[model samples]
Target: MLDFFIQPFFEFAFMKRALVACFALALGSAPIGVILMLRRMSLFGEAMSHAILPGAATGFLIAGFSLPAISIGGVIAGLVVVLAAGAATRATDQREDASVAAFYLIALALGVALISMRGSSVDVMHILFGSVLAVDEAALLLLGVVSSVSLALLAALYRPLLLDGFDPDFLRSLRGTGGGTLYHLIFLGLVVVNLVAAFQALGTLMAVGLMMLPAVTARFWARSLPGMMAVAALIAAVSGYAGLLLSFHANLPSGPAIVLACGAFYILSLFFGRVQGILLRLLPTRHLEA
Candidate 1:
């Protein structure tokens, strides 16, 4: 059994790519996810993930080429949509979430329509479900570049983002620093880029899951923000590797497999979290009888 698990580490190039991509993705998405969760903007992440598909297809159409170029184009598209949504909402009575959902649904529809014109099943699969095994060298390099840029941006903007997340009213009272808005835009861009980078390996739908689920699950066990981020990253990394192995051994789709692994952790965390475990429930029930 151990050899069956260990053999792919030595035998497959795709497996190697999958592992590396997942690790990079985990690091890139997890901390950002914690921020998103903190701000109650997990839906925004979902919107951004879905919003990139048309950009990706357009990039492919324009470049007649690489996934990285397509991904960059997708990220740009997503950011544009987000900016447009925010601007549109500023003048309307409609809430920000409503605007986000409308933009996401429209973008998703457009992307599907565009792809459906002449795309193959494989192309459709890649857009909807991702293929970690299909990651090329260029895509890998793009992932690394995206991850580095994201980390640098996070380091520079961490304090402001924290402030914005925890107390937007206080930030507003401090009056516009301009830097705060800039950091927010840059962070949004990072989210878009992360979605684009992971989309090919985890699909638009599941990529958002990867970004949010681990972070949410980590909250049950982590008492601090930094601890939550660390646990989220670890969960993402482990699930990525485990999903690849499961896919290889079970002939399953890698992205969904990874999501399933994340789901497993979420369920486990629900029942066995450090702060709210099954033991706590059992003990309380016994005390009720006493």
Candidate 2:
């Protein structure tokens, strides 16, 4: 088993890249995901995941599987979705969620149509499911750069972002203007870009799961934001490693296996978490006599 586990790292460059990319993704997405959940933007992440499909398809058509081109196109489409959703909310008083859902559905359909027009169904399946086992050195470098920049940005904006996450109303009231809400928009755009970059390795759906599940599970264990982020990153990293091992051993799809491992952690957290476990929920309530 140990030999089996160590063999991939020693034998394959692609496996090495897969491990590095997953590590970078675990670090990059977990903290951002925690913030997103706190700020009630979890759905927005899901929306952006679906919304970038059209851009990816367009990029594929134009650049023939160029990673940077596809990533840029996805990022642009993400920004458009955000802008359009914001505008629609302002113009019609519609709920942001409704707009997001509409955009997601439209973009997904369009992306599929474009891919079909240009490539075979097998290519579409690969796009939707991903090819994480085949991740290259260039892709790993791209993931590293993006993850580093994102982590730096998150660190720089930590205070303001937390303030906005916890109490947007208070922040807005304190500032005369929207308290530079536009910055939040840009941050979300960056999240989309990271998601797109990760899509080739994790796929759109499983990428969303990876981004959200670890953070969600960590929330059950930690009281502070920093603690949550740390726990989430740890869980994600461990899950990535374990999932890759399982996939290599079992000959399963790496992306899906990783996501399933993350899901297992989520389920475990639900039952065993210190702060919000089922056992805690079942404990007797204390009463104070008046």
Question: How high is the CA lDDT of each candidate model?
Answer: 0.84, 0.83
Top candidate on TM-score is: 2
- Residue 72 lDDT (model 1): 75
Pairs in steric clash, model 1: none
The 10-residue segment with the lowest total lDDT in model 2: 281-290
lDDT of 1 by residue, 1-290 (tens): 78787789788888888889999999999889999998899889989998998888787666644676677778888987989898879889889899989988999998887777777767777788878888888888988888788878888877778888788667766757675677678788889989998887888888987889899999888988889988999999998888888899899998999989988999999888876666656664554452
lDDT of 1: 0.84
Clashes of each: 0, 0
TM-score of the candidate numbered 2?
A: 0.94
- lDDT of candidate 2 at residue 117, scale 0 to 100: 96
Candidate 1, superposed: residue stretches over 4 Å from native: 173-177, 278-282, 285-290
Angstrom error of the Cα, residue 130, model 2: value is: 1.2
Question: Model 2 residue 255 lDDT?
Answer: 91
